[model samples]
Target: MTVPASTAPPQDEVSPDALQAATTPQSPARRRGADTRALTQVLFGQLKELEPGTPEHSRVRAALIEANLPLVRYAAARFRSRNEPMEDVVQVGTIGLI
Candidate 1:
């Protein structure tokens, strides 16, 4: 799915500090969890406003999947001792996530 051009902020308006801060390591797990929840809520709200089968909707759905990938990885980790490939576990977890 392609992200619509209008969804992106103009490149010239993005400051170096903002980019740096976004890439920097977050605080503790509690703070990160709260941030994730807030982001999810906002994305879902945006998704709700868009029409289904449109690029904007697909972009939001893709964003939701990308945002929660860590959760899939964490769940997949629990099966590490089952003699299965980690990739396989992660793939299955991702499918469940979708």
Candidate 2:
């Protein structure tokens, strides 16, 4: 299942501070959209260096998971209904992401 890319902000909307925040290796919990794009790039770059099955590889993979979690949530929200709990949907989406 493909998650839509609507979580990211348009390139023109990114501010200087947001760009700076994205470049640095830090938690991007507060900044959405543009920041998530930047973090994704950084994480992908790091992923290239680490071999699979290693601890460092797993760490970077986890970072990728966290970075794209909002996407999972956004996708899961679409399926939420009286019968389906949001938490279960999110968990399943997260698993799909992994």
Highest-scoring model, lDDT? 1
Lowest-lDDT window of 10 residues in candidate 2? 25-34
Q: Candidate 1 on 1-98: residue-level lDDT in tens? A: 88899997767677889999889977797677787789999999999999999999999999999988988898899999999999999999999989
Report the C-alpha lDDT of model 2 over 2-63, residue by residue, as the tens digit: 65689755557789899998888754654577788899999999999999999999999999
Where is model 1 more than 4 Å wrong at Cα? 1-27
Superposition TM-score, candidate 1 onto the true structure:
0.65
Task: Please provide TM-scores, in order, for all candidate models, with all chains considered together.
Answer: 0.65, 0.61
Alpha-carbon lDDT, every model: 0.91, 0.87
Cα lDDT for residue 49, candidate 2 = 92
Structure candidate 1, residue pairs in collision: none
Report RMSD (Å) for each prediction in the order shown.
14.9, 16.4
